[model samples]
Structures are given as C-alpha cells and as structure tokens.
Target: MTPQYMNISYHDLLKATSGFSSENVIGTGGFGVVYKGIMAVEGIITSVAIKVLNLEQRGASRSFLSECETLRSVRHRNLIKVLSCCSSIDHRGNDFKAVVFEYMPNGSLEEWLHPKESMNSQPFESLSIMQRLNIAIDVAAALGYLHEHGPVPVVHCDLKPSNILLDNEMIAHVGDFGLARFLIRQANISSPSMTSASGIKGSIGYIPPEYGFGSQASTEGDIYSYGILLLETFTGVSPTDERFTDVSSLHSHVKMAFPSRVLDVVDSKMFLERQCPGTKTVCAPKSAHDCLVSVLQCGIQCSKESPRERGTMKQVVRELDSARMLLLR
Candidate 1:
C-alpha cells in the first residue's frame, strides 16, 4: 500500500508522545527536545522520535519550519526519516510544532564513543575496526545521496558524532537537520548569522577553516566536518585537546602521528584482547593489515586541511567498501 502523505494533527501527536512527558524524552538540543513515542495505525505499532519545539523561545518556529521543509523534500537511507509533523496551538493556547522521525534505538554515536555516563553492566564492547569502517561508509553514502541524488544539494552545517545516530542494526543515520542549508549555484556569500550563544556557526572543533575565511557553508565544509568525525572515531580523543592545541588543526596532528606509527591513539576498547603482543592496546589484524592501512589512509585523506584535497564522499564510500571486503576475506 502506498503511504499517504498527511499532516499529523497536534492532538494526535500529543497522545502518541505521551503528552511530551519527561520520562519519554530521549534527547534535547538547541532546536528542540526529542521524545520517544509510539504510534498505532490499523493495529500496527511503530516507534518514532518526536521533536517538539520550545515555542516560548525566540526563533524556534523558524528553525522548526526550516527543518520540516528540508526533511520533507529529501529522502535517503542513511538520513533520518521524517514521518510527519504537527503544527497547531496546544491546550495552553501556545504555538506547538513537532516532527516525527523513525526512532533509533541504539542512540547517537557520541554515546558509544565518548559516553559521558558510565555503562555499568551494559556488556559494552568496543566496535571492531571493520564495524568502524562500515559506519564511515554508511555515513559517506548518506552524504553522497544528499549532495548528488537530492533535488538540491544539502549542506549539513553541523556534522558531529552526536548528530549521527545508530539504529538497532548498527546502521548509521544522519540526524539533526535543524542547521542544514540548501546549496544552490555555488558562489561566495557572507556567513549566516550565528544563532547560538557560542557565536560560532558550526561546532567548535569541527568548523571548517574556510568558514572562518568568510566562505559560505558548502559541501566542502561538510566534508571537513566529516573528516573530523572520522578522526574522532579512529582516535578516541576529542579533536580539540590540550595536546592537539599546539597543532594548527586535527588534520596536522593526525598526519604527524601517522608517520610515527602511532595508530595507538585509536580507542583502547576497539582493540582490547585483539592487540598484538609487545604493543600498546591498539590491535593489528591477523591477516588484514593492508585493509587497516587502507582505512587509516582514507582517514588521513579525509582530514586534509584543504577541502579541495579531500576525497569526495563517493570515493570515501568506495575505499571503505574495499577495506570491508578485504577484512571479510
């Protein structure tokens, strides 16, 4: 059956989201708060992430509408799916708006990577090298789809690990389109006014140098952010660390460390028991050293300071695919 497009009413959304109860709330950000919700139609249950706007806040309505417009028009497997939206006055007679998205049970990549809170007795296992490579490929594919397959090129202004969610199947989904922008014909333009208190457009560590130079947000900026994410995934360290503060950028830090055979910076959890004898916690594959080398090399390429020097998402995806195939063999 074809899925009919219908705007969800505000009342229906409230019931689906349990009246936006705090217990159901899963996450919150500058744009809005996200709540876990269940919807049943024809006796079929479906889980969703409901993003409810903070109407009392300034500029919240515009951001909500902007995200709605972007997600409603774009579609991709790696991108979060927006099922519907609700925009109406609530019982308090205040404006209410929300977006319903496919729920990601596993939560954001940041939780897995940094984990602010301890995962006591959670049977937490570090992701294998192969798993990391697969996630990078999935994210690249999603970005590629947005830049090439969509009706208009979309720039995900904020591409940090926190915004990348992993589903139950470990499939990566790019979420938080609140800061996304459409890239029409490429031309120089002034930076968009910053919305947050930081006075910075993108996340601090991931913001592209080009953006500082007054270049408008472009696909290249997204590429730069992707590179930072890749580096963060490989190395358990945050991009802006006291050690790396001396270095001009994350790219340079990684590049200098690469020549020293210091992939040891990679997450200790990722290698664990797999680490080679007489070495640090970093692991070396039994027979796929070449594959590991390739993946690391791709990371280096992506982290290049010059956007023109970095490989496209298509190329990144292909490289990861090749590495994954080698690891499987």
Candidate 2:
C-alpha cells in the first residue's frame, strides 16, 4: 500500500513527546534530537521516535525541510517509517519542527554490543548466534533495497551499529536518515577516484579511506561502512577498541588474524554455554563457529580498500542469508 503523508501540529508533538522532557530523549544527531513519544489516533496509542530540529541554528530550518523531502519519498522495511511530521508554531508562540518515527524498543545494536554500566542488564544475553545473524541479514537487506530498489538510489552515508535499531522482536531497522543522499545519474560519465572535498561525514574509523582522498560518495562507501558494522557486531567490540591498537586498525587486524583462524576474537557470548569446568577457552558449537567465519569473510569482502573490489549490498545480503540458514539448520 502507498504511504499516506500528513502535516502534524506542534501542540500534537508536545503531547506526544510529553512536552519534550529530558527523560523522553532517546538519541541526538547533528541537526536535531530524538525523543520517545506516543500518539493516540483512532483510539490506539502508538509509540514513536520524534526528531525535532534545533530551531536556534541559523540554517537548521532549511535542513529540516530537505530531510523531510528525502524521507517522505522513500519507504522500506529496513528504513524507519515516518508516521507524520510537525512544522508549526507552539502555544508559547515559538516556531517548532519535528518528524515522528516508529519506536524501536530494543534501542540500538551499539547499546546491545557495548552496554553502559547504567544499563548493564539490557538483555544482550537473549541474542543467540542465529539471532545476530538474522539482524545482520536484515540490515544488509535494507541496504540492498535502498541501493537498488528505492524510488531513487540512496546512500545511507552513515551505517554504524548505533544507527541500527532493533524492535521488540529483535528485527533490525536502519534509522538516522538525516545523512542519506539520493544517487543521480550523470550520463554515465566516469567519476573521480576519491572524495576528500566532502571532508569526512561519517563516524571515525568507519569512514572509508577513499573518502579522505576525494572519492565521490557511492554505494561502495556505504559498503565499507557496513563492513565495519558487521565486524563490530561479531566481535562485540568497537573498531577503535584497544584490542585493535596492536594493528593500525580493525580492518588490518582482521586481515592479519584471518590467516591464523583466530575466531576466538569473536564475541565471548558465543562461547558462554560451552565453557569447560574451569577453563577460560570456551569451545563454540561447530555450527556457530562456521557462521562466525562466514560473517567475518563477508565483512572482509565488503571492506576491500578498492571500491571496485567491494561486494554489492545484494551479494552481502545473499551471503548473510546463507549463513543464517546454515546456523538455523
């Protein structure tokens, strides 16, 4: 079914977000802040993620409209669905602007992989090997859809664990479309090899090397980011973690360790159920180990330094799907 668009009022947003209270805030971005909100339409209370523009900024209003235009034209299961938006004056006569999204109860993959002390009991233990594989597949599928099947091809620009949110059922959804860009066809002309002029828009460590050299942002750039995310998901460690310091970076470290079959670097949770009577080395089930190896290989392929050498999102999805099927079997 086609999505229906509607303009919501600021008062409605205040009610939904509980007056934009500090407690309702879930995340923050460069252009706006996200808050948890609820709205009752047709007698049903629906939870949402409300991203309100920072009105005080000089040019934030323009960016807000651009984001709304980009989001309103696209729809996919992996992308966050926009319930509605508000860009009007509030009761205090202050101008306001905000976008509403479906709420993701499980927070983000980042939080689950690297929980803070304040939220230590946040249920990462519930994710089995199969479940992680499923989430990875969902993310890859979403990227594939965006790159190949959207109304216009789009580059997610920022593909990180923190932007990948999981719902109550653990289904992964790629959020934070503020940095997304639509690809344009330019008469099949050859593009530059680098994109340094853009000046690094993505998170540190996840940014591709070519991006620093002035290579134009392409599907390949997103592939590189996805590769980093995949490795983080499996290792349960950030790419910039101390363990990766011995080597220059996570990519190089993984390449070096791949030859040694060093799968032990993967998440400790995988070995939880198989620890021996009194040993630190826990044996992973053969199926789980194989799945981990496959996932690592996919990450490596997607992260190849040469953009031309990287696998497309479609291929990544296929490989992840196969790994998931194997683990489930």
Number of the predicted model whose TM-score against the real structure is largest? 2
lDDT of 1 by residue, 1-329 (tens): 22344467888778987788888877887878999888864457888889998877766786787778888778888999878778888998888888888899888777777775433223345777767777888899999888767887788888987889889999999988877877665356432222232223678888888788776677777888888888788776777766766546666766766744645556667667776689665666644566666666777787676877886888888888887888888
Error of 1 at 245 (Å): 1.7
Evaluate model 1: give its TM-score: 0.86
Candidate 1 residue-wise lDDT at 225: 88
Residue 183 deviation, candidate 2, in Å?
Answer: 0.6
TM-score of predicted structure 2 = 0.89
RMSD of each: 4.1, 2.9
**How many clashes does each candidate structure show, in the order listed?**
0, 5
Query: Model 1: runs farther than 4 Å from truth?
Result: 1-6, 41-43, 56-58, 117-124, 186-200, 246-249, 276-279, 286-288
lDDT of 2 by residue, 27-143 (tens): 876777889888874457888888899888754675577567667877778777777778888788888888888899988888777876213245555356776788888899889
lDDT of 1: 0.76
Error of 1 at 319 (Å): 1.8
lDDT of 1 at 268: 65
Candidate 2 structure lDDT: 0.77
